[model samples]
Target: MIQSCLTIRGHLSKSLTTAKLINIRHAHSGIIDPLQLKPLQQEGGLLDKLISAIRRRSAPAVWKAYTDLKDSGKIKEVPIQYHSMTLQSFRLNENGYYSSDKLKFYKKCISDILVATKKAQYKLDVRDYNVLLRLYGQSRDWKAASDCWNEIKVKKNEESYNLYMQAAVQCKKYDEVFKIFNKMNNDGIQPDVTTYNTLIEANGRMGNVTEADKLFRDYFAPKNTENKSTSIISKYFIKDANLSTYTPSAAPLSRCIPPPNAVLSPTTDTFEALIDAHGRKKNTPGLNYIYKTMLPQYDIKPDLKIYNALIRWYCHSGDIEAARNTFVDMEASGIKPNVAVFNHLFRHEALKRNRPKVAEAIIDYMRKEYGIRPSTSMYATLIRIHNKHNREDEANRLHTIYKALKSKKLEEQ
Candidate 1:
């Protein structure tokens, strides 16, 4: 295997050496006229065919050909082609690991690809900018993505719009989502169902119910008459909330927002997800309305999954008592407490507050009523909470149980 790897490396080295010998004409600037350069046209002789191929937009075939010729030491003597097409390809390829740190790499890629396309003397096309926009979004460098967005807004691209949709999720540039939405109109880029779904999902997660509702109504529902507005007004039912309640970032709401239109009955799964999102948003009235209206009017049966969702929302919204009540309702409805439901209860009542007695009570309930043994998770949760609160005595107790369980697990293995 080592010998084969060495052989492969040697061949690549030789390929690079040959490529360096090629006399590639520096690609032109801005955009090149692939049409005017008849030699670069496909109908032309061998050289022209090569040029046309390389100039094709996002032409992996052309890129490969150029690479091959360059490796063979031919480009030094022949000219390359550039057009809007090449730029599009460059942009499309920039879609990985673009966290906040590597914004510069995305920019460099755009510039270098643009330069290559120009040297090939091809016309710049809208696709190139679209590709760049997507790359910027993948990078999660909102600032850079915003720049690409402004430049490409004149001619909208699906890739760019998609990036904005994603960037809006983790970054503070939600306006970019709307910007692309508006760009759709000016650039004649129609918003497909996917686009509307993304917008609705994003807005709902951001607690921008107004915007989410508007998008849903305009595109998803167009006829539902409901109170719709995009304000953090967490106070519809109980105005004058302690505004300073729980760290006031949209992070929780964002986390809670369901993926728009989960592939379920349009009225059931989808509405339930949105209602759960509102619960995460901590909009009491919104939660109630969804339970009262969305389920009843829509004829969606309230099932175990719905109950679990409500339990989760109540906990996430900091309504501990309500969460507990919902848990009871779920059991009364004959829904066995799944691990997830129990985990949420433990997290809220015990882990969140280091309430050991509460944790013990939950453990007793699981054993006595549910006939569920305290699994590794139960032991781990207790250990972690006790450790965090510096309750060393309690930690020792849980640690003993955890160790015994670990021993049993290993024995079974």
Candidate 2:
């Protein structure tokens, strides 16, 4: 009997390990593999199933598990951490504005769990609020984000306002951005670099060039202007900016902006925003000046993002040679290009110039140098390019290879 028990235990251990691997893989793909749930179910119970489902990162799977547990009256058996884990899973899964529905579903989960917490008198913490705030920001649900902001009972911090402002920017509510900034000042919360960066981006995006430039000069510019005071409040709370509508006490000379915190050095994001502003307006001279001259003067090392911006601007301005040179310089600078960079290059060369060879070279270079596997879009684009040029054999061969790789990936999952 002892030997038999040991043998069973060994098999169970292997099964559990296999199950964990499957759970992790499938969860990342946003779908739980039903076959992998057996081992976890046998070893544990509802919580284990819920955990496995959350690992799949599928909203429906998690909600199903949650509902199952709740219906079976076993939800109370699940620990608070499990609920928090679900919240965190949702928070971390936010890739961007593209996944708004999933984010809304996650928001619902948060609301349901919060109700449960309240009923059970489970004490919530700031991280919970932060995660919810991040979700709201990513979803661009300005009203929901505002509600979450106003509902925070604890002392509001810079991060809270930053998230709110981020959501407002996504909604293009530039007026709301200033209102929040003023409220932050009134609440005694000093705006940080992130605050200023988001505000600048919002203004630039709305074609409010004057606002963006004023903020840049007042805060991020290497040199200070005579008309603008160094104080944050004086610069932002001026009568002419119409920000005083939010705060009656925020007069032109109200001294609401906090004192300068040392000699402010602009972050990489500051330059990126400036460059984007110019790029959007097709102000190539201003964009080039900032990229070449202003950044070096501030001793700011240009990263891949800056390089990508320059490349994109060049591409837009019909300077393919300059864009190619910038791309080479970026690689030389030890800043590796991400898939987005490659995609930008591929799209530009293939669609704009109809030179599919450039894109094909990019594919080879990316694969050889970075060891980065071609994504589905990459394969599709290559096939399309070949077909467009009447290279039917090459297109078919690429299609076959893509299918084989996709089948293998599915098998692995």
Candidate 3:
């Protein structure tokens, strides 16, 4: 059934491409000029074609459509929005990684748009700045993200602060994370779930478990009567355990009651951050409470990331039994274990625990049961383990396999 649907979609796409080519040929032949074409906003018109091309990530098609619209002299109708869409289209690569060349192109396009809009007296909206900020965040250019934030001429929304904070967190600017949050509050902008998640992660990385815990308790976790007296914003900003000197205006406090649409419940990412924080601190009781109690009470099912965190923590703490039990629970929950999960167990048994046989059994189980292959780093560690144990023959064997896999990967590339 899926194949049939795919076949039909292929035919439709081919038909659409043919139609576009025919239209272009007619335009080039002077059979139909730009003015003779249908209105730009009509169905299947130049604007729709350009938008479709952008959505498809076909740079060539987008350029062609854009050139046609430009020749039609209709691009001035809504130039900034069209430029914003074009900029957004170049934000990511096919593999979902940021490309430097794409980012450079995006910057150039943005520069050109800014110049054109300035001469036309067109003001750039918050969406354009938000897109630029998001691209900078993905590229890990926090400095550029800050510059973009400063360049926002219009009012900043929740997303603007969220993206800026995300970039800050990615660059390990933990102090800036809170500063942005405080600035966001001072601006009378309320944070959403993503904001709280980024704050939690930043605090977690900074080893400020208390701050992260407070954020979760105040904003994300389910609220009770005792915690309901103080509003969410006041609890974090005015009465925080840290940041004593941040005294913002009283205007924001009056608007602290979250709207009905506000997301106040914890998400999986919130739990993940809390789990990782406790794990890094070796706070077993904290991990126990989150994994065994809070998650169940909240009815939030553990995903692969959650299980991986548990396995990593157990492995780090030298509790192979607990790690194995977590792995078993993961499988029982019908969650497929990835190579990272096996890597944790393998590294623990082979290197730290000095049980190469147990590690070998794990690799065997991974391959036979799940058809999972060990990553190159895993092979390197296994090789080291075998060599340390004086198993020279096994070490050489694994070395040869690793080399072959590496060569194969390079050849494919």
Highest lDDT scorer: 3
Write down the RMSD of all candidates, one decimal each: 13.7, 11.4, 10.2
Please write out the lDDT profile of model 2 over residues 1-413, one tens digit for every residue: 00010111111122334346334433442222332333445425776777677657666677788778878877665544455445545554323434455666777877887776665454444456667777777777778878877778866668778777778877767677777878888888888888888877876676544555556666665444335544221232223343223223222212544446564678888887777766666556666677777788789999877887877877776777777888888988989987777777777887788777778788888889998766667778878989878999989988998898788766964
- With a 3 Å backbone cut-off (N, CA, C), the pairs that clash in candidate 2 are 27-55, 27-56, 233-257
Q: What TM-score does structure 1 among the candidates reach?
A: 0.45
Alpha-carbon shift of residue 28 in model 2 (angstroms) = 32
Candidate 1 residue-wise lDDT at 117: 54
How big is the positional error of residue 117 in model 1, measured in Å on the Cα after superposition?
A: 18
Deviating ranges (above 4 Å) for candidate 3: 1-53, 57-83, 90-125, 222-263, 388-390
Model 2: lDDT to the true structure: 0.65
- TM-score to native of every candidate shown: 0.45, 0.67, 0.66
Return the TM-score for candidate 3, rounded to 2 decimals.
Answer: 0.66
Worst 10 residues of 3 by lDDT: 1-10
> Residue-wise lDDT of candidate 3 within 11-101, one digit each (tens)?
1121234345344433442111212222345433778787677657666566667667667876665433355445444444312444467
Q: Which stretches of candidate 1 lie over 4 Å from their true place?
A: 1-164, 192-194, 204-207, 217-273, 300-309, 324-341, 351-354, 360-381, 387-393, 400-413
